[model samples]
Target: MIREALRKLMEQAPLTREEARQVMTSIMEGQATPAQIGALLVALRMKGEAPEEVAGFAAAMREKATPVSCPEPERTVDIVGTGGDGKHTINISTLAALVVAGAGVPVAKHGNRSVSSKCGSADVLQALGVNLDLDARQLSRCLEAVGMAFLFAPKLHPAMKHAIGPRRELGVRTVFNILGPITNPAGVRRQLIGVFSRDLARLLARVLQQLGATHILLVHSDDGLDEISLAAPTYVVELKEGDIREYRIDARAFGLSPQPDGITGGDAETNAAIARRILEGEAHPAREVV
Candidate 1:
């Protein structure tokens, strides 16, 4: 069945949602070989992922993800970005999650270690003394205690263990990259997702819409940064109540001035320091972008 799916993909034929779900199910169930999985991912990337394919994959992932409960799921939001921007900017989404939490919004930030950047959300969070090994119950407790919790992707989506080898070998974008943000373990209906590519911003919004997301903001900077950029205009696609809207936003609209310098790349510790400083009200234009 996996081989047949791969053949269809190689022939430039899109898979039905069920077929994509079955393929992902097999991969998660350890029924597919590493070689087959690698071939399937590469073929899909080359052909470009369809909305159905991404939505199907996300469905299967949600089925296997460890469930984290929220007392008020409707009010909770997840802030995540599909990495692989290769810009290695400071963890803007991570910092934004903290700010959102501080502003009285509950945050269920889903993240993983670095894939294409020097420091990922999980890395910087770990640096700040966040325990990434918490169980589902503990995660819920954290949310109740602090109005925020970080759901480490690897811990939440253990089924992804099967694809780690293939993803590492491919070393490029795949459907899984986008699926991460959409498959929040807490099943939060609200989200703010950042995409590495402009096209993906709309594509991801569509996928989230299909998944019955209540409210979502998909952002991609014109300069190619995944998060809303201070350096250039950012393209935004908002999904709300089954309606989709697209728009472009400039920094000045938010009372922010465009900074000429881009975010610098660094290891987890370095990025964590920057996040700490920003949260402490110390002024820095780069931190203001958060």
Candidate 2:
């Protein structure tokens, strides 16, 4: 199956939805060898993944993840970024999740440890002593009680371990980075996704629309950060009520000055301190970015 798929991919032919789903299922079930997995990922990346392919891959991942019972899935939103921008900036999506939760919205933030960044959402959360090993039931409860839960990727998608070795050996961004933000364990329909590239912002919005997403906002900043940028205008692709629209927003609209240097981040400990200060109401540009 992988060989046939690889042949088509090598020919620059996109996989059908069913073909992509079957291929991803085989990988998750450990039927595909490491060499096949690496080849498939690279081929797909080289050809540029289509919406159908991403949706199919996300469907398989959702089917395999440990399911969490969200109280109101349509109202619940997951804020995540397809990392690997390599900007090493502060964790803005995670902070946005907290702010959204504070506004009384159910937020299930899905993320992993640092990958091509100085500090990831999971890394900063762990540094603050937040437990990353919660089961599905506990995660559900946390969402119900506090309106927020961090769905750690490895804990929710154990089958992903099969692909980790290949992904690490490759040492580059693959389809998994795109898959992570779309595969929320709780099955939330609403999302605010930050993509590393502008093309991905529109691509993912279309993918989520195909996946029957209720509402989603896909953002990419001109300054090369995945999250919305304070230094430059941010391109946005918003999917709502089944209509997808493209637009750009500036920080000045929100009465913010472009302080690009103010948003730089460091190691987990350093990001933790920045998070603490922002949460404590410190007047910093990172807070404005969030």
Candidate 3:
């Protein structure tokens, strides 16, 4: 653990394969002090988390997190965003989960209320009256009943609770922000991930690869959305059957010819209202994209 802190403080990247596993194992064992932990976290962020570091630490999280048992792994899809969009959009990814479910795909989305944006996937979903605090059993039932279930971040990973206050106090985008999307408790093999930056989309792809993700569509919008923007082109990095591909998706593909400026929100209440429109079938562009 001390070595990780030293390496990070030196402005070097992150841990090697064995080192990451060991450090994370130590953390899970409650061996590291709070002071050591905070130092390591801040240093890693400053150095810009490396691919192996993200992969290794996330792998540790996956190991400790409560696993959800699914009868059919092949049919499950997770739709998530890294959520630094700053657009304050009305939970576009959460909205898309409904549309994706409506498309005959089984969705088990993991989300939280907005920390980086005005409304998060969980916030907008909660506004629509879908329960976000369900346990694994209730959540699984919701997925079976509605073809979608919302997995709240706090409910899934209890171990991270201690760091929550520290992360908030740091007042910057911590590694925990990116960790949410990567740590889908449902363990869905397929993922549709939206990131804020084009470069980070590609970088996240590599981490997902290490995490043993099967089929993934990683996207970034030119206009700073964590979703496929109808107003501009969306860059995509995809991994299918162990093959990685990068491409561009035009707004026209979503049937938005005039290019909508993308969904914007003022607060939870405002976004929730938009979500109501989606559920009631107002048939808007957000609806089409979702």
Q: What overall lDDT goes with each candidate model?
A: 0.89, 0.91, 0.77
List of clashing residue pairs for candidate 2: none
Cα TM-score per model: 0.97, 0.97, 0.92
Best by lDDT: 2
The parts of candidate 3 lying over 4 Å away from their true place are 2-4, 8-13, 258-262, 283-285
lDDT per residue as tens, model 2, 1-290: 88999999999999998899999999999999999999999999999999999999999999999999888787898999988777888888998899999999999999999888878899999998899999999999999999999999999999999999999999988998889999998988888888889889888988889899988999888888888887889999999989999999998788877878888899999999999999989887788878
Compared with the true structure, the alpha-carbon lDDT of candidate 2 equals 0.91
lDDT string, candidate 1, 54-110, tens digits: 888888899989999997788999888998777878898899999999999999998
> Cα deviation of 52 in candidate 3 (Å)?
0.8
Taking the tens digit of each residue's C-alpha lDDT, what string does model 3 give over 1-290?
66655565566755775566667666666677666667777887778877787888788777777666554568999989998877766677877788889888889888887888877777777776777778888888777777888888888777766576556667888667787888888899799999988878887888888878899999998877788877778899998887889999898775666335436666778888877887788866566566
Candidate 3 overall Cα lDDT vs. reference? 0.77
